[model samples]
Target: MPGKSLSERIADFGRRLAVEAHAAWLAARDPRTPWPARLLALAVAAYALSPIDLVPDFIPVLGWIDDLILVPAGLILVRRLIPRALWSEFHAVAAAASKHPSSRAGMAMVLLAWAAILYIVYWSVRVAPVH
Candidate 1:
């Protein structure tokens, strides 16, 4: 990691963030997680996973703002809300889980959803009769 290039380091950071976000999602649903922390964790995970953005990524300057600011802020807030020991446990669990690896099922699902949305929009705009 010390020898890694800037781009590689950034990528590593991104991967870690993804793993932690997933862990937060898991913690959010756990029966043992405190209610306040659970709510915060849920919000963090939802915002991170959401395809739709508070500021759409297409817009200049502001588009990437939420990604740059909101998700990390939410994660930080969640960190404070959860007990330290519990947070450490979740972090280790998340790190180990990240190592196990998985397929692109979530990506496939997202693609399918986007395709459906696009089809509906196209059908309504092109096929439906207008005034």
Candidate 2:
């Protein structure tokens, strides 16, 4: 396809955003994260990556609603698990990542490169001549 159809492009963008949110959740939960908030981060990351969901992604508009809900809910759950001071520190880091352009650009470039490499490998394998 010369360019993705509008719906395809939108779907791709939504998926990317969901992945980014998941990454942010993981970073927030790192053990090195303050003792207080570490568990919260872990819980959020686990839930985000988990196969189980409040609403499965296969559904129409309702599917992604889980992404919107789970992330914040996980954060709240983490906050309850940890002390306020530590949660503040992790939140600060999350805010910094959200503001950082280089990190976002790097992630996008890496994903694009990975996609390109996978496409090339698949194409080569499919078109390879028989011995």
Candidate 3:
């Protein structure tokens, strides 16, 4: 395939990351998984998705550092929790999903719609007079 647009690449990476994170979380929570590992994965996911952050995204390169740290850390914690067999199974699934082709056009359309909605909301807020 030809070179992908930045947005498409980002979206594809985001989707794959989400898939891997979800698998890791599930494996960590399996009954066969150790309680300590499960708890750690839960905590990590919560922190990663939380609105509050140690470093805000507006801070240049540092903004994304949390993501780099959190994701791998969470996976490591999960691996420690789950059995080797189960983890191997989940890893296979995640690998398959990553190899699957992503629909760039569909993702772009969804992003555009979201942007349009946000723009409309911003326009309305700006034009509305304070009571």
Best by lDDT: 1
lDDT of 3 by residue, 1-131 (tens): 88999999888876766666656655545677677866775555445434445556789989788777766677676777777888787667766663433334334544666678889999999999999
Scored against the true structure, residue 111 in model 3 reaches a CA lDDT of 60
Question: If the candidates were sorted by their lDDT against the true structure, best first, what order would they fall in?
Answer: 1, 3, 2
Tell me the whole-model lDDT of each prediction, alpha carbons only: 0.75, 0.58, 0.64
Instruction: Tell me, by TM-score, which candidate is best.
Output: 1
State the lDDT of candidate 2 residue by residue for 1-131, as single tens digits. Answer: 59889899878865544454454464564665565465555455555544455455789989877676656566556667656665566556544564422234334444666678889999999999989
| TM-score, structure 1 vs. true | 0.67
Model 2: pairs clashing at backbone N, Cα or C within 3 Å: 29-41, 40-78
Score residue 103 of candidate 2 by CA lDDT. Answer: 36
| Local distance difference test, candidate 1 | 0.75
TM-score of each: 0.67, 0.39, 0.52
Arrange candidates by TM-score, highest first: which order? 1, 3, 2
lDDT of 1 by residue, 23-111 (tens): 78777878888999998887777667665665568999898877777778888888888888888888888878735333243345546
Range of the 10 consecutive residues with the lowest summed lDDT in candidate 1: 98-107
